[model samples]
Structures are given as C-alpha cells and as structure tokens.
Target: MSAANLYLERPALTPAAEDLREEVRTFIAEQRDSGALPPPERIGLGFDVDMTQRIADRGWIGLTWPRQYGGQERSALERYVMNEELLAASVPVGAHWVADRQSGPVLLKFGTEEQKRFYLPQIASGNCYFCIGMSEPESGSDLASLKTRADRVAGGWRINGRKIWTTNAHRVHYMIALARTSPAEGARHAGISQLIIDLKAPGVTVTPIISMAGEHDFNEVLLEDVLVPDEALIGTEGNGWNQVSAELAYERSGPERWLSSFRLISELVDVLGADTQPSTQEELGRLISHLLALRQLSLAVAGMIEQGKSPNIEASIVKDLGTKFEQEAVRVARNIASAEDLVGNGRAPRLRALLMHAQQYAPAFTIRGGTNEILRGIIARGIGLR
Candidate 1:
C-alpha cells in the first residue's frame, strides 16, 4: 500500500495523521471556547468523566481498537495524533487512558476469546477502566522481587497481596496484576502470571494516597483471596514477565509522557514574551530541544508499534527523557515566573493551580511507569552496554 494509503487505512498506521491532528485541534478549540475544558495545567490530573464521555461519544477513545470491540478501527498514528492533541489541551482523559493505551491491545493480542469479547468492547466504549498492579511494598522497581502471590484453586486462583501506587484505583474497574502463579524455580522471572482482577471483587480494598498536590490519584489496593476465573488469566500462565514488559513500551511512549508540562510550556511562551532573561531563555531552549528529541524517539517507537514490532528500549528512552523534560519544564516555568503564581496573584487561578500541581507531581513523572534508573538500564541493555 502507498504510505498515505497504509497510514490512512489502519488505526495503527493512519495515513492522515496530519489531518487527524487538525481535527483534534479543532475539537479542543471548541471545547475550550465552550468552557468545557480547563486551561492547560501541565499536570497530568486530567480526569473528567463528562469530558471522557464526550471523547467516547465522538469515538476517539478506541481509535485503534477493532470495530467489533466498539473502536473505529483506526491506525496507531491516528490514535497518536488524537492523543497528542488531547494531552496538549490537558483534556481529562485519565479514565480510559490506561485501557486504551495498553490493556486493550494486550487483551486483543494475548487474551482468550472470552476475555476479549467481554472486556475489549467495554474498554472501547469507555465503560471499563484499568489500573496497573505491579509494584508492592517490598518490590518497587525490582519487579522480579514482587511478593504478590496467587495460589491456584480448582476453578480459578486465589490472589493475596497489596499493590501500592495504583493510579485511580478506586474508580478503575480492573487491574492487570502480576503475581506468582508458581515458584520461579531457578529462573527469577519464571512462573509469573498476569491476572485481570476485578476491582469490585469481594475481598478487594482500595485506600487513597492523596498526593502532595492534594489530589486523590494514587492508591494502595489490598487483594485478599480474590478469586480470578480461568478467563481472567491473560496470555499463558507463566509468560507475564515478557507480556508486561511489552505493555510498558506502549505505556511509556504515548503523548502523555511529553505533554504533562505542555501547559507550562505554553504559559512560559505567552507570559515571558520577546524580552526573556538569559537564564529563562536558556531554560526554554533546553526544554524545547529535549521535547523535540523525545518526540522524535517516541514517534519512532509509535511507528514500530504500527508496524507490529515491539520497541521496548526506544520506549524506555523516550519515557525517561520525556519525563525528565516534563519535570524540567515545570522547574523552568516556576523559576522564570515572579513566584506570584504560587499564590495565584498575577497568574490565572487555573494556571496557578496547574503550576502548583505540577510542582508536586513533577517527582512522579520519573517515578511512575518505571524509574529513571530502570529506564537507563533498559536503554543501556539495548545498546549492549549493560
């Protein structure tokens, strides 16, 4: 197929990424003019159910999901364009972000027929949301050391463990949990399994972890003998390590990685016009360079995903670099301003809120979705240095 045809034809390879961008931009403009969406906040606390429902109503949530699953069967590039525009506008997209990003794709690729049929459509329709269940108290970055255990039962399995730092745990419907299905034997990574645990299950408990920004985003989930049916097992029983690794690439390379500070970038440009100071000018230039570089790297990974290749290392690099840039953008913005935004003095309340919010959440940009150290390890291994 021609490049345009190839891109236009599939959700993963939309030939019309540019056109899609404009369309999304127009939608964001309309939303802004209607006062339906808040001004850009640079923070990633973009969760508005009504706004999410609006996106879903417009069929943007599952741009790349299969039609049978309620998606429009768009290409990855199309979805990429849509995602960039939404995050740029700081749209409240937290509800369906995780499901649309990776969980939906993972299920489509590795789940059983029953699993796909039940969950995929709901996800595409914005009815089902998912959070990750990877880190535990004892195991934060070293996922191989996670202690969340899953004992086998006749009909299914009984899960018992605590998952910390689960984003939107209280609102999400499900979690893709990594647990020990069996002992790892001699291999540290063996016998692990991914279970699709219903958050509303009888023994499940979610406790909020209010962030420094005073937002209730992260939570600690306790799973006590939660029964997961055979259908809840994603992929093979012992291949979760590899499966979740692939999913990380999808999580790490999306527009959200770079767009978190986009609001701040915009404000910096608007407020600090032609006569910016030397230090402020230097910082802005650096942020732009890093943003563009991360974009190129992330776009390359998106191309790989469109072409059915897993670009885990590239994803990690983009995630690490993009996250750092996002944090730096906040710091630069905070420093450049006269510190009035801190108390909403000269700055708009929305901008002040977002700025203060970004200050608090900046630490999480590197911490969440895997740490900087872990990503560097992945990149180093990719280049044969590790």
Candidate 2:
C-alpha cells in the first residue's frame, strides 16, 4: 500500500541464463542458415509448426516448468533470456506461444493434477496450442461485464456466447474462456469462471477478424450450446476473476510488450549509420534508452514471479509504458525512414516493409491485452491514488 511498493529492483541474471541466451542465439543462427527461419517481411510472432517443434526438441518450450511436466526445471530468468533472443530475431513461435506463456502457467497454478498431467507435457513438446478467450464483443476492457454464460447442464456446462479479438483461435487447438457460471451477485467479479473449451468441438465457430496489417491472426469465436465436462473448469467455480488477473500479469509483463517493434527499430539503425545528422542521433538514442529502461522493469517483474510474489501492479506498469514505447517506436521508425529517404527508390526495402506493417499495427499496441486507460486505473488503485 505504500509508494515504496513501486520500487522494482533490477534482477541479475544467473550465468546459466546468460549461457542459455547464447544457445538460443546459436539456434537462431542455425535456423536462418538452413533457410528455415528467414527474416520476416511482417512483424509480430510468426507461426511455424516446424519451428516450434524444433524449439521444443531443444527443451526450450517450457523452460521453467517442472521436469515431470516435460520441462527442464530451469529458472524463470532463463526462460526470459531465451524468449528475448527468440522474439528479438522474430522467431516463428506463434504456434506454442500462448500455451507456453499464459495457458501453461495458468494450468500449473489452478488446474487439477489430472489437467496438468494431460496438458503440460503436450504443451512442452510443442504438439498442442492454446489461445486466450477473455475479450467479448461488447465487454471491451470491462472483463467483469462479459455476457458469455456457461449454464450448468446435465453432464457439465453448456456455454452460449461469443468471444472477440481471440488471437490465433483459428490455428490453435483450445481456448480458456472466461464465462459467467452463476449470476452476478454481491460483486460483479463473482460468478466468473474460466473453462477450457475444445475449439474443434461441435457448435464452436471461429471467424477471422483481420487486422489493418491484413493478417488473419485475430478471430471471433461463437460458442453455441458447447458442452464441456465438469473437469474443464479451471481453478474454482467463482474464482476466475483472481485467476485471470494473475494470467494477465503474465501476458502484460513479458519482453513481447516492448520488443514487438524492435525489429523495425533495428532496421532503422542499419539504414541510418553514425554519420547521420546530430538530430537523428538524438532521436535514436532516446528510443534505445526507453527500450533499456523497459527491459529492466520487465526483468524485475519476472524476478518477482520466480519468487512466488504477485507483482500485478508492477506488471501493469510495464505493459502501460512498454506498449506506449512500442507505438512511439513505430512513429520513430517511420519518421527516420522518411527523413533519411531510406524508403525512396526502393532502397532499404525491408525497412520499408517493416515500417509499413508497424504503422498499421501500432494502434493496436495499447488496445490489446488491456487498454492503457484500464491499466493506468489498476496502477492508480494499486498505489492507493484512487
């Protein structure tokens, strides 16, 4: 409750984590040399099932999970280092990203022993995939205001509602949906529950919601009388609000938040060397400084999670500033391209394509996961300002 709670001590990575970073870099280099993982023309996490399997083959998928669950029992900081390298190079991790980052952790924390045994190994092996089913068409960032209801049925729960902005729902195998299990009562957060729904089951429909970047990564899923067994319920019947808050902490604090536009920035740096105008140098320096600061804050949150602490407020702060930095990076990249004339005459074609894609994707940076407005409110309330 004190302002001092906002202080985030920098995390010192273990030697093992640093070594893991080099190993990941070597893997990336090998993949690129084999022409399997080429530089992407577009941004965001690229999807490649083969690439995911290769990562799993190296025991990198669930790096920090228990060995019994097909993990290496490594440190969270090691996982952090591996992900930083993979994402920085824009590795095709889309296939297993959701399962590894959010769903696997959620299951580990709240699922029954049977559920963990059933899903964790598959996720760690990169054979299974998952997507988030939190946002509703009408609910925006007010998650407690969702209308998706899962009424108690004969064998289990019969779900009937729609979920929007579901990332990779079409390609993934399952979705952990947040639905109203019981009517809202004393508090709106009550009665909410998360249920793992089979995307291939009958009465489940997935429709694409393409982004301005002309990608089919987002989808809207309709659940019509979808019946799932009682075991599908994650955590407790009415404890979904708490579980989702924890899941969002994972979603909002990763390097993905600040590193989304990193490739574009890197491309800009390559196109504009040190001999550029002093004004340009200042702009580039400012952008890089913001990135380093965000990385430190993100590392602090990762360390807290490893220590069995819930740094939800700190996670929100990271996402809030990190996403804004992403948007700014896009603008900076575009401006630098225009000023340097790097995009003219088809010169620096890769940078041109990346800048174009980033511009289209930048607006959604603050919108996804949770809106900046909503995150700021969480930060204010956490600091006792509200």
Candidate 3:
C-alpha cells in the first residue's frame, strides 16, 4: 500500500479504559500528597527508583503483558490511559520507561523462555532497568552505519565499540545493544545482532554526557571486550535491524512525544488568569486542539500495535508532528510570559522553573528517537513519495 493512500482509522477507548485515567490520576495525586513524588516542575528527565517500585507494586508497569510475566493482561488502550496520565503529570518514569515500553515487549517477542522468565518479572517489578544502545558518535541518525562489533567466542560474544547519547545508561542495569556479528555482505543492515549486555560487566563503562541543560540523563557507553553469553542474543543473528525498527516504533510513538512540554502549557494557563486577553486564549486553544489531534493519532497507533500490526509510518508521523508541537509550545509559552520575571519574583516559581527547563530541553525534541528529517523521509517512503 502506498503511504499517501494509507489511512490510520481512529480507535475509540472502551469505557473501562477511560475509567483507568481517573484511577491513574488518583494514584499520582496520592503520591504527590504523600511526598513520594516531587511536583511536576521539580522533575527533570530522570526517574526515581523508589517511585518506579511503588508503581510496579500497583501492577501498572506491565499492564498489557501476560499474567505469568507479572502483567495485568489489560488492553493497550488501558495502558495508553495510564501512560498519558503519567507523562502529563511529569512523573519521574525514566527508570523503567525503556524497560516497560520496549525492552519487556522485545524480550517477550524474541527471547527464549529462560530469558523471559528471568527478565520479565524483574522488569515488571521495577527491579531491573534497561537502556538502548543504538546511536554512536559516528552513527547517530544513520544507525545502519554503526561500527559496534561483536565477535563469536567460546560460549558468548565479545563486544567492542562505543555508543553515544545512551539515555539512562549510567542508571540502567542492562542494555539491549545492536552490534555487527559478521562483515557486511550486501546491505549495511546485514549481520547485525541484538545482545542483552550487562552494564556492570568488567569492560563496560558508562561516562555521563551532560546536556546543555546540565542534566545527566545521557551517557556515552564504551564496551571493550565485553562478553555476553549466547543466551543473551535476542531473536536470531542478522535480525537486529528489523528488531530495532520495531522497537523504535514503540519508542517514538508514545505520550511522551507531545506531552514532554505539557507542563509549560499547564503553567501558562495558571499564569494567564481567567480574565486573560482573547488573543492569548485563542493561541492556547490552538495548542490544545493540536495536542488533542496528535493524542488521537497516537492512540490509533497504540490500537494498531495491540492488533499485532506494525504502524511504522503512522508512528513516524506522530513523532514528527508531536515534536513540532512541543517546540511550538515552548515558543508560545515564552511569548506569553516573561521567564525572567517569573524566576526573579516568587509569584510563579513553579512556572519559571518549568519554563527554564522546557526551553533548554525543547531543541532536542526533534532530534531524539529519530531526527525530523529522517522521519519525514520514512513518511515519504511510506506514502510512495520517496
């Protein structure tokens, strides 16, 4: 099917799924009230382990996985409600975000029974965390050109390469990395394999890469002669490219894509009183309309995933549009209020902090997960334009 002719039908959430939103909101409120979680403005792009554990105890981590895997066996719509609420509240979900969103599902799809038995429970329980090792210094957007190599050894594979911009690498216990298992034969995607590498291994080093905002969530991971057991291989050798593609669909098309700047909007509303100017109101309304539309698009993708269909093109669309919206939100908020006044005066400390953080973080919104240009190319290809 040509991408231009492709249509993603809108999917409605069940009443039961809609009800899950209130339950999630209540849980978040209780956590905030009990001081278990910081206010949205204070939260950076990192997760709190204790908070993740608390969420796991509620069985919200693996909401759609099997019962034996410590999941609630719920529908994707239900998971969507919970995830959207969490991101909207700016909860610190970074710790288990990768694991719950992608790693667990990947393992379920490709891991051996033993691998599933060992990792799924831990991930669901929030005792284990994971990072993605895809982009390297020389190969950021062009993942097919990654130079990380893993050679077959006696009982395992010895990996040697570096992965840059690895989010949560310093905090995660494991990384699901892609490496070259053999020489490139025809395509650059050939001979690539996915391995579950232990981050605590002898030759594995994670050096923090502070962002322009001075956040320490990203790292440069170096693997030198790091041995991963044969059992750690995910799916088959030479299939990493396909597997990672699937993983990126999950990574790119989520509530986080648009909701990353939600706090700015929330604060904007608070700062702009109910008696604000009509023009400002119109602008805010426009942002809300875009947010609503993008959200429905994202939910449709979630439904596709639940139906066992890969919505790669649709996901790319969401990430592209959603990221543009995020960047636009920052611009609107900046124009609406003076960040300097808010920071200097204690009247809007929370708004000031959120604005400061969002301003610095906005530039990367279009870069991470996938570059905007790359996503547009994928979209064009899907639509038969490329």
Candidate 4:
C-alpha cells in the first residue's frame, strides 16, 4: 500500500451511536448520584466490580460481539460512543476493560468453539476480568525479546515466566499471555504463542507493583510451572506475534488514549469559570482542537474495525499523538494553577486534587500500552519512511 492509502477514511457517527451517548451518560450520572462510582479526582484507573456488573446487566460490555456470546451485536461506532462517555465521566470500567476491548474479539476470531463458549459469555456477563501478559521484566517494549517460555507437556503446557507492569493482574481472573513456545527461527517474531492462563491456577503468583502515585494497579505475575490444558491455546502454535500485532490496533486506538486526563481538563474549566483570561482560553482552545482531531482519527479506526479492516498504522499514530496530548494537558493545568493555592483550602479543591493526580500520572501515559518512541517507529515504517 502507498503512503496515500495510509490515510484513514473519515467516519461519521450513526444516529444509533448518538442515542447511545445519552444512554451511557444517563447511566454514568445515576452511578455517580448513587455514590457507586468515585469522583473524577479519586478515580484511579477506575476499577469497580459492582459498577462493571451493572454495565454488563445493561448489555453494554460486549457491544460489538455476536449475540450468541451475550453481546448486543452493536456496531463499533456505538461501542466508541459508549466508551467515550464512560471515560469522559470517569466511570469505573477497568474491571472489564481489557476483556471487552480485545480479548473477546480475539477469542471470537481465533478461539475454538469450546473456548468461545466457556469464556465469551462469562466475559460478556462482566463476571470475568482479564489482563494482558505481554510485558516482561527485561522485555518491556521489545516484546520479541521476552524470555517467558512455555514447554509442551502431556496434557498441556507448563509455563514459567514473570510478567511485569501487568495492570490489574492481581484482581483479574485470567490473563491472555504471550509466551515463546519454540526457539526463534529466522526472525525474533517467530515461534511465539498465546495462552489463556487462569490466574488462580496452582503455582501462579501475583504481587503488586505500586505506582509513583501510590496506586496498586500494576502487578508482577510469576508463572512457576503453571500448567494449562491444551484448550488454553488461543490459536495455532507459533503464531502469537501475528495475533498480538493484530490486537495492538484494538489496544492503541481508543478514546482512552486521549481522554485519560479529560477529568483534569473538565476541572480546569470549572476552576477558570466564566471570566477567564484570554491566554488561558487560547491554551484551552488549542487543547480542545487537538482533542477533536484525535477523536476523529480514533473514530475512523473504530469504523475500520467495524468493517473488518486492521488499521494498525492509524492506531499507532493515534496512540502517539493522544499520549503526547495527555501529558501536555497536565502541564497546562499545572501552569494555570498555583501549587500552594491548589493544596490550600480553596473553592476548587477537587480541581486541585485532579491536577495533582494528573501530574503524577502523566509520565505513565506515554509508557503504557507501548512507548511513544515505539509508536513513532511503527508510524515511520507504516508511512514507508523507515
């Protein structure tokens, strides 16, 4: 494909998606009013079991999957609207985020019938949570260099490896892990496979890795000869690299990439009030402009997924730009507010709190999922510049 072909086709939200926006907004408001969800400032990673189940009961968890798997079989555009509303409202969606976002899709595409029947419905029901097992101790962004290995056994495979920076590993019931099943042949990407490992299986250990903000979301998961049935394999053996690459489009292209600090932006606006300075307004306008453009790009990616197209290059571009914008939003918020006044007893205490949280969390925005440097490299290759 030529560089010109890399351009994403414009996507427009349908009327159904527009209606879903209001429905999701109303649900979020009800959750907030009932105190089931935390305030934006206090919503760290936003994981709430009760809240996830509530969303599931509304048939919103697996929005784009087949109805046989308990999904509503809605369009990806509708899922996009629902996701944006939840994140913008700072709803606690972390519990089912990964499963709903990628795992379910992966299973539907590549899993055996038994695997699909066993896992998809549970995931759609919000009773199951999953974490990604791609990052390892020495192989953070260089996933091909990962040393985690799985050896073939009589009835299954015995896995022995440690995964780091795994979000919610301790709280999740299962993990879709990528491990080396065979030695690298000609390329490093070869000889790898994905497995559906039960986190509570014997010899599995999960230890929390607290963040700089003192949050316990990240985890270190160790698999010590953990055995899984042959049915645990996601697809064919020695195809994990391809499977994971395909999944990255889902992982990277989303409203979450840009909306992580939206709470801070909203709070900043509230603090600035009606009679704000021109300079502040200019900065806010610039931020909003970038956000609008990013949203369009992300929506285009969603449309591509709905059409069964893999927009990996576009997804990488979105992630690279979105994360940079999130980090910049934190800086702008900090410059607009005084630290002393922010920490002091003020009318905008919640805004101050959110600003502080954003600052501490800003560094990880570019690092998680994939680093900004890695994303740029992918974009360079995609554009035929590399």
Top model number, TM-score = 2
Candidate 1 has an lDDT of: 0.82
Off by over 4 Å in 2: 1-4
TM-score of model number 3: 0.96
Q: After superposition, how far is residue 230 of candidate 1 from its true place, in Å?
A: 1.5
Model 2 scores worst on lDDT over the 10 consecutive residues at 1-10
The 10-residue segment of model 1 with minimum total lDDT is 1-10
**Candidate 2 lDDT tens digits, 1-386:** 13645867777899998999999999999999999976667888988999999999999988888999998999988898899899999898899999999999999999999999999999999999999999998998888999999999887999999999999999999999999999988899999999999999998999999898999999999999999999999999999999998899899999999998888887788878767877777788899999999898888888888888888899999999999999999888877777777889979888889888888988999999999999999999888887
Estimated TM-score for each candidate: 0.91, 0.98, 0.96, 0.96
Regions more than 4 Å wrong, model 4: 1-5, 339-345
Candidate 3 residue-wise lDDT, 1-386, digit = tens? 23475678777888988888888999989988998766667335467898898889989998899999888899987898899998888788889999999999999988889999999999999999999999999998889999999999999999999999999998899999999999988898889999999999999999999999778989999999999899989999999999888889989888899998887888778777777666677777888999999998999988888788988989999999999999999888876675223345477777778888888988999999999999999989988885
Candidate 4 TM-score, C-alpha based: 0.96
Q: How high is the CA lDDT of each candidate model?
A: 0.82, 0.91, 0.88, 0.88
lDDT of 4 by residue, 1-386 (tens): 23544877877889999999989988988887888865677535578898899999999999888888888989999999999999888887899999999999899988999998999999999999999999999998899999889999999999999999999999989999999999887899999999999999998999999999779999999999999999999998999999998888889999999998888888777767677667777787998999999998899888988888888888998999999999998887777665324445566778877877778888998999999999989988887777
